[model samples]
Target: MRVSVKVKPGSKKGPLVETDEDGSLIVFLRERAVDGAANEALVKTLAKHFETRSANITIESGHSSRLKRVRIEE
Candidate 1:
């Protein structure tokens, strides 16, 4: 399944929220968006959320933007 995600980097706490209108997932990362730290956090967060390994998650698009598309391998 393809899902839309909005990433929030440098957050004090980590949590995932769902958009009411679009149903996109909002992910919060405690790590700052530097040197791919936020991206790594995102992958880890998603992997845990889907009960999968970090390697199973891949950022398909928007690597440098707040909005991203992630592909989760089964």
Candidate 2:
């Protein structure tokens, strides 16, 4: 399934995930958007949130943007 995510990078209140009323996801991550750290964090974090593996998550777009589209193989 593909989902839209609003990423909060370098957030102190991170490592958290929330869902918006529109059905999109708001992801709070502790990792900063440096050297692709936040992107990597996004994958790993969502994996845990969905009880899936990191390899199962794929960032389809928005590699350097706050909003991203991710594909999760179910």
Candidate 3:
């Protein structure tokens, strides 16, 4: 399955993920947009939310952008 995500970087309460009003997912990352920290955090959060392995989640688009398309293997 594929889902849309909008990331909010540099949050105070660690990483958080929620569904957005526009039908996209909202991801809040405590880490700044440096290296791949935020991306990794996103993956972890998604994995836990979907109750799947991190390996099952693949970033299909927007790797370096805030809006991301993630593919999850069921």
Judging by lDDT against the true structure, name the best candidate: 2
Report the C-alpha lDDT of model 3 over 7-49, residue by residue, as the tens digit: 8879886577787788888988888779998899989988998
Residue 49, model 3: Cα distance from true site in angstroms: 1.0
Model 1 Cα displacement at 38 (Å)?
Answer: 0.3
> Which residue segments of model 2 deviate by more than 4 Å?
none
**Quick one: RMSD of model 2?**
0.5
In candidate 2, position 58 carries an lDDT of: 99
Using lDDT as the measure, name the better of candidate 2 and candidate 3: 2
- Expressed as tens digits, the lDDT of each residue in 1-74 for candidate 1 is 56688999988768564454678888988888999999998999888898989988999999999999988888
Candidate number that wins on TM-score, 1 or 3: 3
Mark the regions of model 1 whose C-alpha exceeds 4 Å error after superposition: 15-20
Q: Write the per-residue lDDT of candidate 2 for residues 1-74, one digit (tens) a residue.
A: 99999999999999999999999999999999999999999999999999999999999999999999999997
| Candidates, ranked, TM-score | 2, 3, 1
What are the clashing pairs of model 1? none
For model 3, what is the error of residue 65's alpha carbon versus the real structure, in angstroms, after optimal superposition? 0.5
Q: Tell me how many clashing residue pairs each candidate has.
A: 0, 0, 0
Clash pairs, candidate 3, are none
